[model samples]
Structure formats: C-alpha cells, structure tokens
Target: MTDPTPPRPGSRAGRKASGAARRRTASTGARIREEGAPRVRLPRRLAPRKSPTQDRARETVEAILEAAVDLFSSRGYARTSTNHIARRAGVSVGSLYQYFPNKDAVLTALLARHLAAVESAIHACIPPLRDPAVPLRDGIRRLLELLREVHEADPRLSRAIEQQVGQMPVVPEGLAGYKRDHVATLAEILSTRPDVRPGNHALMAVLLAAVTETVSVVLVHAAPARFGRDEMLDEAVEALCRFVERPPGRLS
Candidate 1:
C-alpha cells in the first residue's frame, strides 16, 4: 500500500498538530519542574510587555493599576494574583497581559506611578528652595510638608510598596536614583546659601535624604499614633538642619 501522502510543510493541519505537541510538551515540563523544585518568586518581567499610548489603552492601564493598588493594599502582595487583578480591573486576562507581563510588573508600574507623582511635587517645590532669599529652614519645612503629603496620601499603599522593594529589583534602584537627584539639588542649593555651612555637602545631602525618607515612611505608615505628624516633621527638620547647618568650621 502506498504510504499516506505526507503533510505539506505549511499545511494548516500540520501546524495545528505541531502546536498541540508543543503545548503538551510544555505542560509536562512545567509539571515536572513544579514538582521537582521549590518556586522562587522574584520580581521577573519588571517592565511592561506593551506601553499603551492611546487614550483607551491608558484608561485600561489606569484601571488595572487602581485595582492592583486596592488589592495589594487590602490583601497583601503574596495573596494577590494577576487573575484577580484582571477581574477587579474589569478587563480580560488577555487584555491585562497585553500591558503587563505579570503581577510583579503591575506592582512595578504602580510604584513607578507613585514615584513620578512624588518627584513632580518635589521638583515643583525646588524653585522656591533655590531662591537665595528663602531661608534654609523655611525651604526645608516646605520640603518636609510636601513629602508628608505624598507619604500620608495613601499610607497603606506606601507600606505595600515598601514591603515588595527587596523582592523587586527595580524598586530600590528607582528610589536610590530619586534620592541621588534630590541630594545633588539640595547640595547645589546649600552651596549658594551663605547662611548655611553644609560640611561635605554631598555627604550631608545623602544623610538628609535618608533621614527624611525614613522618618516620613515610619511616621505615615506605622507610627502615626506613636509619633504625631507635626512632631515627627519637627524632629526630622531639626535633625536635617543640624547636619547641614554647621558652625562654619565645626568639621575642622
């Protein structure tokens, strides 16, 4: 008997059969790996799979982000799933994947949004700070007020973002870069102020950024009752000013 005619290289039936085989192989391999190894969930696919420039796409992304924030803040990261996020956002899972590769990427996007908002506020406050006439203490208090507004805006969401920082690689880098920019700006401003003697302005800037961020997060996230908002702000302003405003030759 003649052998059955071979399926053409580009035949639809052949392609379908090949795809089925691949799916089975992938399924088996995934099962074996799942059974053989412990799952380590680091923040992979930290970038979006697709960036939505259209207004409709942007709205979808916003909905997804808001849903993620609510779920992450209420349920915690470990418990929230991409499927849940898609459902909450009222988008299909396929639509969710069109923008984000996974839940971690969603979290990354949310953190990025938060960072942008905070940085915008800080930048807007800088022109006033840069005025040589503005008292250093006044500039600092204004800065402290701006930061408090950001941190206290959604304390639960801020805490949720902090909890995922170590696991997600991009968060720390983003935050560090933000602090570095602020430090450089603060140092330049200090350099122009005759009333201030920021000994090693670079070092003082770093310390000031660190102290302010830590104090703001702690006061807004965990210790609002333990420490009053104004009280914490006053203490932070005092500490930062003391570090930057040395008595001309205090270091010497």
Candidate 2:
C-alpha cells in the first residue's frame, strides 16, 4: 500500500489538531453555559407571572420558591441552575420560567418573600412591646426570641441569600425600606414603654435593630458550641435592655 501514501502529508497531524480544537471548543462551551447564563436582569421585577390567584397556583409558586431556597442553600447560587430548581420543585422548566425568568429571579423572589415573612414576624412580636403591661426586658426578650425563630427557619439559606445580595453591585431598595420600617416600628414600640429612657427613640431603634440583627445572625449561623442558643439570646437581650433602659441622665 506504499506505506499508506505517506500518511497523506500531515493527515495524522491534522487529525490531532482537529481533535484538540474540538475539545477546546467543548470546554469553552461548558464554561460559558455555567458562568454566562442569564443573570438577574430585572431584580426589582421578580414577581410571579399571574399573581397566583388560584390556590393551586399559589401552592405551585410556594413549592417553586421553597425548592429554589433549598437548592440555593445547598448547591450554591453559581452551581444551582433554573432546571435544577424546577426539578426540585417537581414542576416543569417551562412552569418555573413562567414564574421566574432565571435562577437569579428566583433568588430575588425568595429574598423578597423571606423579608416579608420577617416583617410579619417582627410586626407580631415587636408590637406587643408597645403595651405597658409588658415589661421592657420581657418585651426585648420576646422580640429576640421571635427573631431567633425567623433566622432559624433556614439559617444556611439566610446566610447564602445575604452573601448573594452582598455580591450585587447595588443594594436592593426594598431592603433599605424594610430597615426603615423596622427602625420606625421599634422606635414606636420603645416610645410606648415608660421604662425605656433612651431619650431618642429613632437612635435607640437603630441601635436595637443593629444589635438584634447582629446577635441573631451570629447565634443562628455561627454561634460556638460553648455559646448555646439560650445563652446567646440572654446576652443579646441584656445588651439591648441595657442600651435602651439606661438610668436617667446616664446616656450622653
């Protein structure tokens, strides 16, 4: 066979080059699919398509959201795909897309839903502090307990959402609004309590909000074994009560 026609003048080399090129292309395509898929284009518009007027539709939305949260907390945002969320939700990808545009949209919706739940919980727990019948220290403890419950719902998911939001180029305006509302609510509650001598309700509210949030996050997500949950709560309550209920003329 004449030595196979001298291997067709670089045919073997060409085959090797083409094979490498194909692999390179495949690798590049995979990277693109992983990293360059659509992100949260409109973070603000992360609402379900039809508002889920029907009970079943609402349930579907909840399922999708819960599945997204589990995936985000466990698989991570970068690794979690819309398809995975849909699969976990037990809904078709088309149905998932009907509600969420992409993975980021689902994250945004989950964050919004979580914050709303927190707000509702805060309203339920903090408002009772406004009652004169409730002792200041007791009220503080109750608020702390309620917050602990909220944070405990899914600490891993909460932390993951926090990190994802932190990575954003801009803070969500709704989050800022929530903070303002919480501060305002706390200020009103403190204003009602005669024992609280903070002198400045707004400042006191801000401080309490900061302290409670920091403590809750630490206790729920990263508290050491030595610092048990109840111990952490007690310490946090003590700190807040002290800060808000200082002796008259003691605060500068």
Model 1, 1-252: lDDT tens digits are 432223323221232242353111222222221111112232445766876655556656767787788789988998877877766665557889998887778887777666766787678778877886877778778877887788778888878987786676455454446767788998787787777774777776777777877866765666578877788888878876777774656554
Error of 1 at 190 (Å): 2.7
TM-score of each: 0.70, 0.70
Q: Please give the range of 10 consecutive residues that has the lowest summed lDDT in model 2.
A: 2-11
Query: What tens-digit string does per-residue lDDT give for candidate 2 at 51-127?
Result: 55444555467667777787789878888777776656655578787767656667777776567666766777765
Q: For model 1, what is the error of residue 64's alpha carbon versus the real structure, in angstroms, after optimal superposition?
A: 1.4
Give candidate 1's whole-model lDDT: 0.68
Which stretches of candidate 2 lie above 4 Å from their native place?
1-44, 52-60, 168-175, 248-252
On a 0 to 1 TM-score scale, where does candidate 2 land against the true structure? Answer: 0.70
TM-score of 1: 0.70
lDDT (Cα atoms) of all candidates against the true structure = 0.68, 0.68
